[model samples]
Target: MTTRTMLQRPAFHWLAAAWPYALIGLVTLLVRSPTFGNPILDFDEQLYLLVGDRMLHGHLPYVDLWDRKPVGLFALYAAIRLLGGSGIIQYQLIATACVVIAAWFVRAIVRRHMGEIPAIVAAVAYVLMLNVLHGLGGQTAIFYNALTAFAAWCACKANDANTPGRIAALALAAMLALGLAIQIKYTVIPEGIFFGCWFVWRLFAAGERLRRLLGIAIAMVLVALAPTGLALGAYALAGHLDAFLFANFTSIFLRQPFPTQVRNDQISQVVACCMALLTTAGVGLFQLRTHAHGRVYADFPLLAGWWVSAFAGFGMLGDFYDFYFLPVVLPSVILGAFALRGERRGFTFGCLLLLWPCIFIPANYFSRHQGILQTSRMVSAISPYVSGHCLYIYDGPTILYYLTNACIPTRFAFPDHLTNPIETRALGVDPVEEERRVLASQPGAIVTASRSVVPRVAPATQALVREALVRDYVLIARTPTIDRTYYIWARRDLHPGPAPLVDPRAANPQ
Candidate 1:
């Protein structure tokens, strides 16, 4: 065979098409691999995994376990557990894949109006922005961002489709993807509405009759609503519909907002980190005017609409947690790509580098992974105390529950539900009553922060837990950490001996 035959092979074609994305995935892996085997990166992912682990054991989210997060989020985690068993790396790997896939779609959108270089820059921005904004581990945004990005990419395809049937098919696919994304988290509702309207507007612009346009609009609406409708219907049939409804829908509105200080800090950090990227995106938009970029100008709304709708999602609930900003990262970066259209290769690469500045805000998000080895030391020192019954982390990391693999005594498994002062009114159950009930169950182990560490804790709940610990539990070990210390407590009634502390480097990582 001629030398050209080798390059023309089917496998070679696949490799040619895939290498760019595969390389992106590899870089993402290296950047994120440090946190892999190190669980407890954040409270949210650990709790999701714990619930997902329980789900595999035939426990349902709203019925058996309680958290205000949507059922689909747990189901995502449950799928990870099925594939990788109870190990933490499965979810982290899965979340990383989702982030990379989302970046691929981000590139796809940029490619429509820009070249491969800007598109690649956009994809890279999406991945790095996640780390800057705290998307490192298995946060919900990691999963849903991929879904929503796919949906938006589908909408972009519909924009370019010529025939009516093709447009309808692409639009329906976009709606279906958004519908599923909504189940993952309701925050996608605004984005879905915008996409749905984009399709309807496309048909209207094509001069379709009122009847046909109306039918398409209604069809898109129903398809967008279908996943959530099915979730609600399943609970209705299970006779636990009310429970699901309260936890998923009604409770979020009732919850108390975070304190003003917490709110201000998050906003300031997001702005500080986002300034460079936003400036780059703005410069790109500004340059468009002088450059006469006709093709980009024509397609600008699709990109701008997505960024507005997706970023607006973080504010929907009046909560501004770092991870909630995940959905917007892709669109922002893609818009920032407008800056790359300039001729200078050096300047384009420097623009991409601007994304890293945000990493400083999370402040040791990456560095803290080093502490994972030291922190795992507490597992051996504490797991023995919770050998049979359960472990309750009243004032510590929720990851401890997974680390110990102990039973949880309450449906409110998330520590924030009981510990945060503002959550007292939001959860359907009284926070104090639930905490007392957990204490009464007498978990085999209870973990609390050392005196110096102070996060947002409810004074009433703290007092109750502290008094109970003093009366009933003994400090078996004081586990030192990179930042602060935590106490592992065992029941005094057991007359527990000194729990030997495992060396920081001792526990084998999975």
Candidate 2:
């Protein structure tokens, strides 16, 4: 039979043909087994985990913890913690399941638009993409991104005439999922904006005028805002309204320009942006030429548009990290896979042949950088040290949540006078007064990025820390990895001491 004849086979027959691909994708996902790896405790992960841990202990994210993230994320983490016992294994399992389910959604969406083979290819590509794999680690952002993709898939499925009810259900689901995504990281805002636009387009295509669209939009807004509004109400009731509004919301939005070290090279930035745009455009052109009228192909533009929106939004923020693009890039992988499938057999094979080396060559080089592997190891090793002591970590939240059963604070506080002057001033507090308060409190320990500890503090505050170390405090240990330096300091007498004289040289230690 001709390829076209085979492609036109009955749905059940097509399912039978595609079963092998599904099985392969499933096995690949299972073997990758999200839980086998240790949890990496980075700043965001640590904070999220801490919030989850606190929730488990009756503290809320924006309430007891001073975080700006919406409450949906914490609630989800709380649910996971309840189910999985708050271990790395449980969290990994949850993350893995989320990815697998997302893959299934991708398959369903693809099957609806493209034929079985293209659907299978899309699913497999999604499962194997570097960003997808990168997200499998125990971070709240991964779950949030997966949720975003799942919501988009639901919307795609619902847009079909045969599935209006399904679409409504999916819209509701998307609304709720977005609530949770926002809670995990506010960055999902741009993603929501992108999806919201698509949702409106879908409504418009359904022959609904502005009035109907407005009604549906209002309903969606209400459903999405319910969880967030409820969380805010709870925060107000707890008498933390100011803290929630100021610290979590306003403070973050008003953050200063990117520091010198945090900024990327302009040339590299332009190059990365070009590569992303070209790849997206290439996929779009391929789709239009090969399957112009295909529903599956049609969805590509919407998905790609959302991705482009997210990338542009994130890029302009100046804190662009490769992983920030994971949510948007994930759908593109499937589109790219389908694009490849539509190519001539020989060309497709040639592209496949070059793919591995293209990825691995650079990855291998990055692995050799100083402290890279060591930093990874330190992050992975955080699970064992979560007992008894209140774990203070600057960069390792994912690790902290998996390992400890203690209440983790939201923001990592520095010594009072040493706090970022700009941040302190922005919050309308005198840095010196805040410093005195923090010193008086005499926290058990302070954990921070080694470099930030210097630049963020005034010379006098730096001197205070050095003097305290020399007299009233002891250096418990110093954990230096390629990407991080963790200094654990303890009181020399395990109690407060006389306020020591500040040495100016302490701040700019040569």
Candidate 3:
């Protein structure tokens, strides 16, 4: 009945060890479940799912559906769609698993250097940080960051073991994971390079001989390239090698540079992020400098390198989207745990600081009540013409492609390629040619939104598609929403309700 007696019980010890994981899972579900089944937004999620559907039908990425992301990304979405068949919950489940695994790795890495308390706090912090900003969504970072953390853990193990067999195995594991991570998002390649440096430093620090080190290095190189090489081989076999090369490797450099104002906004967000994540950076710097002579400090360099390189690479474009920051958070949380070592009450204080965003930001940033049902009316209006025929959406939600279950006539899903010069140039796709091809196919129904919409297709792209519609189609119905007017057009031969689809803007005279 005494506290000491109770603590000594097997059941009590088991409960103590398992509660944190259970709690993390519970919290992840609570925070993410609401929008788990909601209709896809017009963001990356919808775009990815649309591409995934095409792949499910045996069409390859960039060949049938074009996006600049790595093929592994499309494969991931395909897996999600295959499992859940377009339901949002499958993606949510995958997202939750990622956070959980990332948190576990954060705790594992920290617990190696410190007490159980700091490790738990760091793990919990990792989960909390993920939920804040746009991290709650099913971003690529959400999945790959877990593997990144696992790679970090493997690196740490390699250093700790310091034996040839263990070191080689762990090194290979780390490099292979890093390769897969690279395939998920090429931006993380910088982190892999950083890891290479860390791997070399560890070998040297362990006084690895020239012969042994060279052999290990050779093995590591082969292992690292294996995933990418296999992917390339698969594409080559499928006759999409050129498409894969252009989208995954070449397109990144060709992306249009951000304009002055947009760059400034992104810079401001980066600054705010640096301020928000100052704890990780500060701790990492302090540990690397102050404990330079300590054995444990050897790991600090790797953490610092990962943080700096990942931040630089991902932020290279100055894109400040909330989810883009997720990859960099892993090293930050690990460094934070190291920073908290030996401090009294550090766990409580650290948790409070880390949980700040989770407590306040999401409620304000995300809508409390929004669902797929909001778009039901729009789907209803356009369903008839598009249900069984080809559909083209010049300025509408990509989700419409899913709801209507129609064939998309072109590789370009949204008008970003047509409107944004950088997007057009980066993808190496000619929007005009694509428009001509798509229009030549003559989709049975074409949907466009008025310019007033928050995210209408690029003006020029809209104009090109709109011009073709005017010349060949007739408007059957127009529905007005708060943000924009939705125009549904049918081919003139179809005689869709005797209305002129010819530039409703010109005819209505608003």
Index of the highest-lDDT prediction: 1
Summarize candidate 1's per-residue lDDT along 318-343 as a digit string, tens digits: 97776787787767777777777657
lDDT of 3 by residue, 1-510 (tens): 999999999999999888867876776677666557655432567777777767888877888888877788778878888786555667778878988888888888877776777777777777777666466667788888988898888887876776667777788888899888877877788888777767866786778888988888888878877888898999999888998898878887876666677666755664564454566547646865576655466676666777798788767555556567778778877777766745554644575547665554544134323445545666775677664568887666677787788888887786455555557577676776777788888888777766532222345555667677768778776765434566777777766456743554832211
The stretch of ten residues in a row with the least summed lDDT in candidate 1 is 501-510
The number of clashing residue pairs in model 1 is: 0
Clashing pairs in 1: none
Tell me the tens digit of each residue's lDDT in model 2 across 430-496.
Answer: 5455444444544444343456522344555445445545654444445565454555444545534
Error of 1 at 373 (Å): 3.1
In model 1, the Cα lDDT at residue 420 comes to 75
TM-score of 2: 0.73
Point out the higher-scoring one by TM-score: 1 or 2.
Answer: 1
The C-alpha RMSD of each candidate to the native structure, in angstroms, is 4.3, 6.6, 3.9
lDDT of each: 0.76, 0.54, 0.71
TM-score pick, better of 2 and 3: 3
- Which model scores highest in TM-score? 1
* Candidate 2 Cα RMSD (Å): 6.6
